[model samples]
Target: MAQGPPPPSTPVELLTNKGIIEEPFVNKFWGPALFGTFTFIGVCVSNWFTRRPVFAGIQKHIILSGTAAVIGKFVDDYRAGYLAERDAVLRHYIELHPADFPPFERKKFADVLEPWVPIR
Candidate 1:
């Protein structure tokens, strides 16, 4: 009996195959987890600064990436004409049911408030 090729004996492979972990965890929640943790820390620090005002000017920086992602998606969708098409559908519905969507008469609050002025 000639020796066959050695079986795959990597420690990680053995542990995984032996049910230590069926599959490794691919962490997709790191961003949200880190954000929440940092936010909690910021709140704690703010509490610590009770004697003086806590001026964290970089608050927006925390959410800037997510905000930009949303804005980018919106712009891309608009450029693709999806937004225009959706708006057109909404307009068509409003036109179809004019009673439900009353047309706006362009008049200022001043016109309503000043009865002394001549009604033009």
Candidate 2:
């Protein structure tokens, strides 16, 4: 009897249903859980060496991490708002004065404005 078609040659084509099922769970939960556990252990050990109580060290870690997270969120929001305003202004200007931008420049702006395009 003839054999089935050759197995997938490339890594991308070789993925199985099990791999797909595990990928998201590993990415969304396992990675962060591992990192947080390691960080907590490191902080506790460092505090112990410094002669600080374990609970107090944990409290400090929580407070500092919370403050940092809030500050990071505010910064992210500000950056997003700034980028939106800038893109709007650029698009409006392009619309008002199409002659000012050549086709190449227009393409550049389009790429830059695209949300999926990474900033260099």
TM-score, per-candidate, Cα-based = 0.27, 0.42
Q: Per-candidate RMSD vs. true structure?
A: 27.4, 15.7
Best by TM-score: 2
**Residue 49 lDDT (model 2):** 87
Q: How do the residues 1-120 of candidate 2 rate in per-residue lDDT, one tens digit apiece?
A: 966554543332332233433334443344344545555666777788889876565676766555555555566567657976776676666667757654432236766775787679
Q: Give a tens-digit lDDT track for model 1, residues 43-119.
A: 54765677534444445444654555455555555554775576567756666676775544556798787567766
Q: How does candidate 2 score on lDDT?
A: 0.56
Any runs in candidate 2 off by more than 4 Å, and if so which? 1-56, 104-120
